[model samples]
Target: MSFKVAIIGRPNVGKSTLFNRLAGRKLALVDDTPGVTRDRRSHAAKLYDLHFEVIDTAGFEDAAPSTLQGRMRAQTEIAIQEADLIFFMVDAKAGLLPDDTTFAGIVRKSGKPVVLIANKAEARGAQGGMLEAWELGLGEPVPFSAEHGVGLPDLRDAVVEALGADRVFGEEDEDDGEIAASDVLIGEDIADPDAEEVPAYDENKPMRIAVVGRPNAGKSTMINALIGEERLLTGPEAGITRDSISVDWQWRGRPMKLFDTAGMRRKSRVQEKLERMSVQDGLHAVRFAEIVIIVLDATIPFEKQDLQIADLIIREGRAPVIAFNKWDLIDHPQAVLAELREKTERLLPQVRGIQAVPVSAETGRGLDKLMEAVVRTHRVWNSRVSTGKLNRWLETILAHHPPPAVAGRRLKIKYLTQAKTRPPGFVVSCSRPDAVPQSYVRYLTNSLREAFDMPGVPIRMALRTSDNPFAGRAKKRT
Candidate 1:
């Protein structure tokens, strides 16, 4: 079994800060599920070559045993039970409160080796709490300022001592041995640890897919249906999701990291910091995603924020696919789909070739088609075209359509080359580059997208006047 280390403490005690410090990446997908982490956040963590699984759990509060807070408390307790060692963190500046006494008793009884961590200890003011941590009866406290990057070596040593030198590697446990950090965490995850190590079929890493749109748009239902489990908190609440939560899984043998974000609305009435932060966090998910699935309510598909979100994704350089979710709820499905397409074509011309997959996320109606689009778009994003073939294609297209006349002059379209891919962009050299008409540019772009069978991927073409290859030749004038 992989060794597990759980960090437990009250809220705002730097537990998350310490977690981020050790994990070295803020990969946590924060959402509506407050403390008592909705899912076990595990990552490979190492100390001086000793690799193990580090679990950042929700903190426990000393509240009545039957409330929602108590249930959250139970979740943390479960983490404590599973941990090989428990780092009972405390706010060094807050000193010891009655609640700390209540929680200390709970941790003391677990019998698992407890490492008392004094976070925010950089301030001399924390001396009182540093001393108070000793009173928890978990032996000498290991003072650590998780934010200031203080006392890491000592902390590592404390871990070794508690876990034992033999247990440092999982060999001491049974059926497991020296592990790399990723090995430990990825093992418990849904995706194969080998999928990451092995030569997977796809070159692209798990594409970050975000399901976003207005509230009650079946975003959660779609994700649950996709994963075949109720992983997110779904309800009738308009904005049930307060934070973005990501689940790692595989689809058709391709590893994927999917994020389900809170429904985004306009900021006209948003008045709270916590709410604003939640919205911003959701947008951040969209910004990080490779393909954002804008889940729209079938009844009222595209709203102001929906268009805004789609525009933002394009601006962020991420491919977008629209899922008109709750298709079953629509009266005239085909007509509505057609209308939506026409509207999207007009309002969002910048994202020229985006796919609009009409399906009910509730019934798993069109997921296969959705996946097909995602894979197809991703392939387009990673596609590379040879220069020789590209120039040949360009020659045929230019001859067929021809550049439009600029004033009395017939503009000449010259050689072409692809500058980038991932949306497969191209640069075309021409005479009087700026003289190329907008209609001609659109025609060329549409032709490229259609010819390449690149349905949903963004295609970019730029015109530049080429410098004469012999411009630098010395004059032979007498």
Candidate 2:
């Protein structure tokens, strides 16, 4: 197990900047806005030879116990308790505020090894403030500049000395490869340029999955149930999660990275700057995930927003598995299940025969089936077809219902081949590609889905005009 370090401070003190700097990537969203980070986010961080898990938490704030800010403070306290060491950060440029002194005392009470970081130390004006930070009495303040990458060596040495070099290094000898901030793996990344074809899915690599849905859709609850732990913050509130928190876990012996994203609302309804950032972070999670599980409220499954979220997932070319959450609450399970199935197929015909797994996040009912569906849908999404087989299938398809004539010329499809997978995409060479109607393309798409056993995953098709050798020949001159 690696050492855990939590960075806690008042809002806008450059804690996130320090987190990104230590992680060697911008994993957390950084802006001038205060309170952008509401939930705690943890990432594998490396500072030269020291390797440990670093948690970036929301700023410490004083608020009523029933308020959101108070709940955020509660979450921070949990991190402090779990962490082996805490980096008490302060804004050197802004000087020490009353809140900083209050939080500093709180950290001192925790009795955890504390490293005082005076951020914005690059500014000459911050020099006086850094000197003032020593009065807090935690320890000597390390004047560090998170943005300018200054004084990081001193900070690292301080951490190493505090945690002890033996404890920091542990038994690990080399640096674990860097994990990207985005954590998104696109088709291009999986495809090998030197190889003749796309490689098979590496089971050794953990599958990146994100749970997304509208506000209060039980997304976080579902993930917590799946992981068998209360790793995420959940409540009656609609938008408790403000950051895309990724947790690594094993599902039936298979490695998986599950991301619990903030509840997404319609674009027009999003107003506050913090909420807007939260939504963007959720979108980033979708892009980064190989499979997106859109959790829906069983009582009201097929709302417009649910369909919109599904459409967004399909548009991103990620395999989607619809999990109907809160199934235990539905009094008429059979009727609602039937209606949900029909609505899913009718409304989202783009991904015909999409998997709709009914699972109760509260009771953990049907979770096994949901994971099975996820694995199956992901396989289909990454499936590849041989060129010979595709052309043979295309021949049968064209023979049954040939392309209609356009401009007194019959459209002829010469060949077809699978271009990529992970949302299978295909390209077809035809005589009159431009004239091929979209309805006809839809026919081909539906036929392909039916023939190839590709259900619940998006399929892309591109029409390209085949080369014509005789047209360019000088037959008229003769």
Candidate 3:
């Protein structure tokens, strides 16, 4: 098992900045505002030769448990409990405070080994504060600058001495040449350029599905239901989740990674810079995921923002499945479901046959149907057709409704072939690629979807003029 290290500190003390440095990438959201990180996020990290898992947690506060800040502190406490080692960070420039001393006592009571990191030591006035950090009684403070790469080697030595180099490097020499899930690049569903056809997805790899919706739409609650744990902080508060948290689990023996993202609201309403960053982070998760589950409040389903979110999913070429959440709250289930289905078709014609499952995350009603729909949608998203079959279908489509005349010259579609899958894309060779009306393209797209039974996933078709070998030579002679 990998060793776990958690960074705990008061808000805006550069805990997230240190985490991003250790992870070798910016995994956590960092800002000047206090309490920006409300969830404890963990990622695989390496420090020179030492490899371990590092967790970045919410800043500790002294609010009541009923309040949001208190809940955030509760999460931090949980992180302290789970960590095999802790990096109790203090702002070197701001000097030691009473909260640092208090939290140091809490970490001391936990009985875990700790490394004191006096961050921002590069600042001109940080020397006195770094000296004061010793009063916390954790250990000797390592003057560190998380932003400027100062004292990293000393910090690494401290970690090695505390955890033991053997503990840090255990099992690393066992060479299997296997790639970890973290090492796999994002957008793994895209086609391999060297392969003749879009290859089948490796079942061993975890499927990444991002759950997104407006604020208080039960995304985190639904994820908790699916994973059977309250791993995320949840309550009556809107936007309790501020980061895109990814949880790994197995469903009926299939490995899956579920990303619980911060709720996204309208652009006009998102005036705060922190909320804007949260929304952008959620959008990034959608791009990285192969499938997106858009949760909607069943009571007031298909709001304007909900439609915009769905359209965004389709535009991203991700397999989309609608979860009509809070189903148990509905007074008339049958009628509401019927009306919602009608609205889905009318509002989302791009994904003509999108699957919408009514589920109550609170009660676990219809969870199985939701997963079933997800699996079906994923299969369709990766669907592929042979060139011959696509050309034959194209012929039938053209016979039914040929391309419209452009300037009294008839357009001819020469051939059709699928370029890739994972939200299937096709290339059409035609006489006049630019003259193909978008309406006609829509007709062919709909027809293709109906014929191939590909519903809910975006289908991309590119028009290209067929190559003429002698056209340039003839023009030169003339």
User: Which pairs clash inside model 1?
Assistant: 31-243
Query: Alpha carbon lDDT of residue 108, candidate 1?
Result: 84
lDDT (Cα, 0-100) at 107 in candidate 1: 85
List TM-score per model, in order.
Answer: 0.78, 0.90, 0.94
lDDT of each: 0.73, 0.87, 0.87
What's the TM for model 1?
A: 0.78
Over the stretch 1-478, how does candidate 1's per-residue lDDT look in tens digits?
A: 3588888887667776677677666655333333524333556565556666677766677667565455456657777887989988888888887777788898888889988888888887889889988878887788888767889898988988887878876553332221221221100111221122322236545666878887778787788788897556565557666557667778977788788877777888677665676678788777666677888787886778778878777766667888888888888878988899898788788766678788887789999898888777776665655566667888999778788788989998887766665556777888998888888888888887777666666667779997888888998999
User: Which candidate has the highest TM-score of all?
Assistant: 3
For 1-478, candidate 3 gives per-residue lDDT tens digits of 3589999999999999999998877778889998899889987777787777789999999899999889889889989989989999999999999999988899999999999999999998999999999899988999999998788899889998888877876775423222254343322343443343545745555688999999999999999999998788888989998899988888878988899999999889999898998999999889878889999999888889998999898888889999999999999999988999998999999999999999999999999899889888988887777777777788888888899999999999998877777788888889989899999999989999999999988999889997788776744554
Q: Candidate 2 — which pairs collide? A: none
Ranking by TM-score: 3, 2, 1
* TM-score computed on alpha carbons, candidate 2: 0.90
